[model samples]
Target chain A: MPVIEVTNLHKRYGDVVAVDDVSFTVEAGEIFGILGPNGAGKTTTVECVAGLRSPDRGRVSVLGLDPRRDATQLRERVGVQLQESQLPDQLRVGEALELYASFYRDPADPGELIDKLGLGEKRKTPYKKLSGGQKQRLSIALALVGNPEIAILDELTTGLDPQARRDTWALIEQVRDSGVTIVLVTHFMEEAERLCDRLAVIDRGRVVALDSPAGLVSSVAPEQRIRFRPSAPVDDRLFTDLPEVTSVQRTGGQVVVTGTGDVLHAVTSVLARNQIIAADLRLEQSTLDDAFVELTGHRPAE
Target chain B: MHAFGQILKIETRLYLRDFAAPLLTVALPLALLAVFGLIPATREPDPQFGGRSFLEYFAPSLLVITLAMSAVNILPTVLATYRERGVLRRLATTPASPAALLAAQLVIALGTILVSAVLLIAVGRLAFGVPLPRHPLGFALALVLGTAALLALGLLVAAVARTTKAAQGMAVPVFMVAMFFGGVYVPRFLLPDFLVRIGDYTPPGVQALLDAWTADAPQPLHLAIMAVIAVLAGAAAAKLFRWE
Candidate 1:
């Protein structure tokens, strides 16, 4: 059964339509990714599911409970880490965790959660004094404190340094492994490709495409590119007859060969036959980012 | 409710953490009480004014001012900041009703104002030999009315302020007018006859009525007027208060 389902959802702010006729289902125990550029209504859709904002026209269900009708029940089961959330400046980390814990019937131990998030040393520090990464980890800790069945993490690693981003990614995988269904909203293609079981790419408040990262990439551009620098310059005529070789281009002492299946075998055989010893051999597969741009006809605007 | 208790704990925790702000609110009034109370009864005597010493003149006004500082000057900024920072909205996601949050705030405001008033009166009696209130019931009634009135006005400001900064910007002008006219920094009767005549129609006038009841010569009519102002201000505040 799906943990979350939204059908024909619509939300408008004055004349601006934030979410328009969007629909998606997040299956239980799957890492579902909602990928969109900034202002693409990703947050709005999630907010409606979290019961933070009321939709004008739509139906949303989480854990078989209506988000608006059973808001309290829904909130108890789902954890959310909002974009740029803030706690009181004077509130210490430990105190904030304890306070949030009191809102739920069964919550993870504040100390244990803080320790897991690597916040034990900064437990006494006020929210305002914590660094950006520290704050993000603290927020994740708070979201997980309820021991929720489903977790929504928005803009998961927007400001984190590379090391912190990797740590966060690990933490997310750990959370998912615990059998909690995760709905991740992010603009980072690498994050979506790395973590998402399936991604629904959105544009202009609408879902443009939805599929697994690999499936989407394969659907858009299945061919691969092979590139190498020859130890000695090879004649272009030597590789012209291979059936799998779709196109070949060379510039600045580097040769790029593009083709479909078995291109590697075909190119290597042709090179060997011509006695063209190559250096710096490399093969590039189509990335999710390429598929995104291919399908949308533009880069996902961050 | 449990949520009310939580918000109360949160608000009180903040107040306790900021010792300087709350301390200044309480101490400034108490210091004035002592200074005015120590003056000799015969010094700068005024035939028309009822009090023989400054302490007798300022003690009740000090209570009104204390109420104004907490409810009017301090609360709007804090509540507005909470609204702007998403604190209130975040809490709203919990089972905690907006009523619970408001109740917690009012409880803390009353508690602080009561403590400040008690300290000021204690200093008035022990340090300056100011006589105890001749009419205890009247003093209590006036205190309740004044606190309610000020708190209601503060809520109105919070409801109207779009941002925390706007709330801060508003506090300066409202506080100055309330202090200057409400008989805290300046005695009402000392004003020119034209000003004194109109001041009674405002919060200062209502406070003066309550203070009159504090004197050996009590004025029930003045207490009645203060009660009316408190009710009106409270109604206005309740109508305008908003969470977002």
Candidate 2:
């Protein structure tokens, strides 16, 4: 059974529609991602699943229970790390973990979770004193303290440094491996591509595309590019005549081939036939970043 | 209920760590009492107080001032800061309701004010020879009712103010007005008859109940007015309070 199901959900703030006819299901033990640009209704959708906000129209269920009617029971099973929610500034890391632990019927040992999240050394540090990465890790630790069946993390690594972002991603994989279904809401394409099993690309309060990261990328632009510096000067017609090649360009003594279906194999064989060695060859596949721009008509920030 | 206890424990610890709130809510009241008690003329019985010394006449009002300052000036700011900082929003996602945190804050504030009241009464009896409340039951009822009414008003301020700075700004004028009616700056008996009558209906007017109890002539009318304010303000606060 799916761990969470949101069907035709609609939410609005005054005249502003934050989410419109949004629907998605997160299966058990999968790191399902809600990927979108800022203010794209990603957070609003998750808030409904977390029972933090009731939908204006349509239905939401978690673990087969209605999010609104069974919110108290749902809370016991679903862990949530809200996008901008925070603990008290003076609250120590260990104290925060302990306090949240007390809210659950059977909570995981906070010390163990702290160590797992790499926050053991900062256990006694107050929240305000912790660095951004440490604070994010601590929030993750608190979210996991209840030993929930499903965890909803919103904007999990929004402001973290590159190293911290990668570290958090690895931690998220470990959490998923422990049999917890995770719903990650993020705008970072790299994060969605790396961690999510399947993604729902939300744009302007609607789900524009829903598929695996590679699937989404391939759906928008399946053509791949192969760039290389040929050992000897090569004519563009030699590559253009190939069946798999769509376009060929020569820029400052380097040859670039854009094509689909065995293009790599076709290009290499053609280069070999021409008796020219292709040096510095690299295949650049389309990424979710490109797919996102194609679907949303702009980049995340734009 | 268990959540309430845990929240209260943490909130109390956090409250004590802050130096300013404790100084204003707990220490300042006692310090003021001491400073007023040291005056020779205040130690002598005065005609204005019907043979009671100034220190004796002022003890109950000082307790009211302590509770009023905490409820009006301190509680609203603390709750509003929690909302501003997203603490309440965070708790709303948990099995423990954010209402538990608000309840714990009220418990802690009332507990702190009660402790201050006890200390004031102890000092009044020991150092200044002010008699204890002749009607202890009446004094206790007055204290509880007055605290509830003032805290209700604080909750309304917290509900209306979007930020801690705004809460503090809104609270100051209310605090000054409460002090004026509770006779912190001027004796109640010295006030003109109509003004004194008007003060009798304000939330801090419970000071009249406390004074009557201390003088062994408990007035049912003052207690009735306090109970009415407590219910009305409490209802309004409950209707207005927001988690975010």
Candidate 3:
């Protein structure tokens, strides 16, 4: 069974719609990414799924329990790490994990989780005294301390340096390996591309696209661009006549072939038939950024 | 609930870790008593003070000022900071409700004030030759009512303030007004008649505490005023409290 199901979720605050018709399902043990730019209702959608906010219209199920009706039962099984949440300035690292651990019926060992998160030395340190990376790690530790079956982390790496972000990503994969369904809400295309098994690209409170990172990229722009400097002259019709080749163009002593599946193989074989070597060959594949811009009609501002 | 107790234990420890609020809340009032209590003039009974020692006149008011400091300055600011920092919202994501944290804060604030009151009374009798309240029940009743009224006002401030800095700023006028009219800053016996009249109408004002400590019974009128303030402010606070 899917660990979480959100169907036709709609939520609004006064006149402003925070989420509209947002729907997705998180399977067991998958790192399901909710990819979107800021203010795209990513947090609102997950809030409803976590039972922190009730949807105005929707059906949400987590582990076969209704998020709104079975809220207590749901909370017991779902862990959440919210964006920009803070601890008391004087609360120590171990004390925070212990406090959160006490909230669940059966919780993970606080000491073990803290050590796993690499915070053993800072167990007695106050929250305000920790660096940004340490605080972020502590927040993630609190989420998993409940030993919840599903964990939802929102904006997990928004402000971290590149190295810390990569470290957090590795930790998340380890959590998933231990049997927790992960719902990661993030706007960083690289984070989504690196960690997500399947992504629901939310744009302006709606799901614009849903697929794996590579699948979403290809769905938008499947054609690949192969560039090479040919050893001899070749006719454009030599490659265009093939089914996979869409167009062949020449640019500044180089030939650029644009086509769909197997385009590279078809062009290489044609060059070989003409006894020509394709030098300085390079293939440019479309990234998630390209797909995001194509689907959303603009770049997600970094 | 177990979660409430856990949060309370951690919160109490955290509150003590701070150098300013808790220290000043309990220590400042006791410091005043120690300084004034050591003086012989305040210890001697005199007719100008209605046959009561000058120390007795200020003892109950000292406890009232402690309540004002904690409820107005400390308690509301802590709660507002929790909401400002997203602690309350974060708690909502867990099996524990955020209301657990709010309840724990109230318990800690009241507990601190109660301890302060007890220490002030104990130290005064032991070191300064001051008598404890003659009517224990009346003193307890007035203390409860006064604390409730002040806390309700504090909760109202926390409910409406957007940030911790704003909470402290908004609580200042309430704190100052309580100090001035509650007879903590000036004795009711020494205040002008018009100002005394205003003090009589103030909620958690020290006059009831004074009446209970020195008189046979606390006046029904003072108790009724505090009860009214508690209800009105408490209702407003409950209606306006926000987690974010």
Q: Which candidate number would show the highest lDDT if scored against the true structure? A: 3
Candidate 2 lDDT, A1-302, residue by residue in tens: 78888899999999999998898899999999999888999999998999888899999989999988998888889999988777788899999999999999999999999999999999899899998899999888878888999999999998899999999999999999999999999999889999999999998899999999989988897889999999998888888999999999878878889998789999999889989999899999888888999999998762
* Clash pairs detected, candidate 1: none
TM-score for candidate 3, residues paired by index: 0.96
TM-score of chain B of each: 0.86, 0.94, 0.97
Name the lDDT of candidate 2.
0.87
Classified by CAPRI criteria, candidate 3 counts as high
lDDT of 1 at A106: 88
RMSD of 3: 1.7
Please give the lDDT score for candidate 1: 0.79
Ranking of models by DockQ: 3, 2, 1
Worst 10 residues of 2 chain A by lDDT: A293-302
DockQ value of candidate 2 = 0.78
| CA lDDT, every model vs. true structure | 0.79, 0.87, 0.90
Tens digits of per-residue lDDT, candidate 2, B160-231, equal: 898899999999888887888877788778889887777776776645655655576456787787778778
